[model samples]
Target: MNIFILEDDYHQQGRMENLLYQLQEKHALSVKRLEVYSKTELLLQAVQEKGSHQLFFLDIEIKGDPLRGLEAANSIRQRDSQALIVFVTTHSEFMPLTFRYQISALDYIDKPLDKENFEARVEAAVLYAQKQNRKTVADTAFSFKSKYQQFQIPYEDIYFLETSQISHHVILYTQTERIELFTSMNEVLKQESRLHKCHRSYALNPKNVVRIDKMERIAHFPNGMTCLIARTKMKETLAKMGGEIE
Candidate 1:
């Protein structure tokens, strides 16, 4: 996971990096990017550009401005509600301000920087972030490996899958792209329950079906893309769709 530290003190900044590296060496944590920002604006800019779940360590005071860190935390919450935020400060009294600002901080670590306590809190935060990531991937993503590439796509983005003319290949269609997979419809169906085999060659996501034409035996999706629906399976498909046809 990405990690961001907002601290103006050069010594504390170095110490934080050293501890993170030590944690990595001990196999206690994994970091994709470790960045330190002395200013709140820089930190928020990075957050907006990165646009992913991250771990944040914010000092309660930046350049002697007492409320700067809390303001930064509030901005980060507005941008990414799932971010794990930990306050690193000597001002434990300011803890109550977190609730007032509605910043759902993950943890608070006091900053005379006790080595043992710091490591423990950092490790726990890393573990929590990893657990959250796994849960999100399991709930919303579809994973598959083809001969050329592996893909993990969000379920809502996928529109349909169809057998390709090439042997043992299937074409996966999404809102923005189409991919060829080295797999069969049976294997795909086993992985995702949202897809239903509407025809011999096509399995479509009922959620993405914008209109169904019983007369033409067609299922229409976004962008005017259409998939064939077998006459025999039409009744079953319609039933699965709660009989909502347009």
Candidate 2:
């Protein structure tokens, strides 16, 4: 749970850092907290360079541009839809304006901030982010981006994979979805060698495959899908999948 605080005031910066450290030490919290810049370039770098941040503590009002904080946040959300954004402001008036930026301002603490409310909100945000991480599909937690958004296709959901063109890819079939994963066959085999390379270009996830027809040189799955096993690679695939399954 990494937290990036984008507040410019020196005194307020110290206070936020202190609060974050206290929570992590006393609560056994998992966090990588930092105070980011008020400058636009620095703020942009803060949001882009990280793998994933659990929350953004943004001050609605900063020095140079009154709306720069919101601008930085908008950019951050474009890349990561899941990151939590909580505006720290000195007035309730900004509440109405927060929506214009399309941010899910979880719960902003108004100026003359209440100690109890501040603590409660931070605690809630941390717990919520942790919950979301736990709920994501575990079978294939690894994900990639599409034109619309990022999607994860679990390794277990892969019906079968194939390799070619000096690059490897997986033809992933899930309950109600079909996906093409951008990965190399060699990489997949290296990760899970249990996958049977039934052909020069195919790697079958045995769990989804129901049977192999040697006469037809094919593998049949319970879902009525079939894959041809090249004779050249049949012997190797057999040795890996075993002659029979229990």
Candidate 3:
């Protein structure tokens, strides 16, 4: 995993680097790269060019600059949605702003640092980064060509796939988007094992299913999207999901 730290203070930056080194030796973490930037603009530029899936340590206040770290993080998120951001700052008040920014931060570490607390949070962040990296490596995406562009749809991101109303096409429902492809349900099902035929027209991703309403024959997602489950397959589907009727 690549780790980036944005802190203007030299002493604080050194401390962070040392802590990272200590953690690496203690945990035997497989860190691929590490970069520390005193300038927010430089870090933002690098992230824009490199893309995310890296770990970041950002300071809320940079010398002579107001909220530069936060602004840089926002820009980073635009490029890398899965970037792990951990705020290392003296300003505890800025903690609430992470939710407002919707950056999906991993954790927050306060300044005037305690070694125990610093080590603990950073270790947690590294563990999270490793887990996310493993997921990306394991879950390969399904590649397809569209009229305008090619698409690579990851299996974990798919809630379900259905036979499109238009013949010879399939509709894939994800958490945030729906993609229509000129493909067959059998072709799509070959991409992943998590997907199963819940009905004649529908294939379900049990990982995305939060609840199964057996009586109503509906599989509910956390996003409030529901799909029909075949009555004959209800017991089988529930078994695959390891879930009971609600």
Q: Report the CA-based lDDT of candidate 1 relative to the real structure.
A: 0.81
Weakest 10 consecutive residues of candidate 3 by summed lDDT:
142-151
lDDT for each residue of candidate 3 in 10-92, tens digit (9 for 90 to 100)? 99889889888887888788766678999988887665212234789999888767678888888877655667799988888
TM-score for each of the candidates: 0.61, 0.57, 0.56
Best by TM-score: 1
Rank the models by TM-score, top first: 1, 2, 3
lDDT of every predicted structure (CA atoms): 0.81, 0.65, 0.77
| Model 3: CA > 4 A from native | 48-52, 140-246
Question: Is candidate 2 or 3 superior in lDDT?
Answer: 3
Q: Which regions of candidate 2 are displaced past 4 Å?
A: 49-53, 137-246
Estimate the overall C-alpha local distance difference test score of candidate 2: 0.65
Model 2 Cα lDDT, one tens digit per residue, 143-201: 44333223434445557765545444555454344556567666656656556777767
Q: Number of backbone collisions per candidate, in order?
A: 0, 5, 0
Clash-forming residue pairs, model 1: none
lDDT of 1 by residue, 92-208 (tens): 999999999999999999877678888788777767776775675577766554344445566777888999999888999988778788888888788677789999999988888
